[model samples]
Target: MKVFSICHVSIVMLSIIIISTNLMIPFYTVVAAETNCSNGDIVIAQSRVGTLPSGIPSFSVEITNACARGCSISNLHLKCGMFASAVLVNPKIFKRQDVDDCLVNGGSPLAAGSTISFKYANSFQYPLSLASATCG
Candidate 1:
């Protein structure tokens, strides 16, 4: 009797597992595709020079949503000269704590195919006109 009962229980459990696995396949596929946004990458990278007497220039760069679907843009870094600066090289420099803040406020969370712009002050102290400006 004990052996029969154990076997019966095992069969029931196996059926449940099989049913669940089958039901999950379709759901999993949809979820996976939804998570995969179209060509996740920032599209635009435009820079504008700030007008200043001290030869200080400011720049703004944007990242689109396509490149940031499931990405987080935090601790944004600003590289004006040939060498990258460690101090400004942070992902959390945005003024607000959202995706758009990375550009207007100082935060970075440009969503997939979404446009996120960032601004940096280019002064003699920072040296924006050095040669290159990179953001990481």
Candidate 2:
């Protein structure tokens, strides 16, 4: 009888600990689910080659939020699809005009019809064959 009582109490304590842990995790999951944004929200996206003040070759990519509601994007970067080694040489991130405002307000959570630009500095020349220059 003593052994059975101890075992039952141990199981009950373990169950309580598990339930308490599970309850604390809902805060983050709920916040994330509320801000869910799909790929279809981006309607206007474009990229162009630009030059910095010193005439260093640079690339600029922009994305606009076209959905009726707001969404969040943590970070966007350039990705080389094929022959990544030979594609870009010494690519470095640079600041653009309006991007600083976005970071000041919040990293993510872009309002509807708003646009964001990301810049990168590189010596890549124009007319280079690229598999796909995309921002994600």
Q: Which candidate ranks first by TM-score, i.e. highest?
A: 1
**Model 1 lowest lDDT segment of ten:** 1-10
Per-residue lDDT over 1-136 for candidate 2, one digit per residue giving the tens place of the 0 to 100 score? 0010011111111222356556432221121223334455554333557677776666654556564544434332222322122224332221221311112113344565677555555556222211111121
TM of each candidate vs. truth: 0.35, 0.34
**Model 1 misplaced regions, further than 4 Å:** 1-33, 37-40, 67-109, 123-136
lDDT by residue (1-136, candidate 1, tens digit) is 0010011111111222356556432221121122332222334465755654555565665545443435433333333334222125334433323322222225334443455555655443332211111122
Query: lDDT, candidate 2, residue 50?
Result: 69
TM-score of 2: 0.34
* Residue ranges of candidate 2 with Cα displaced over 4 Å: 1-36, 43-46, 52-55, 69-107, 125-136
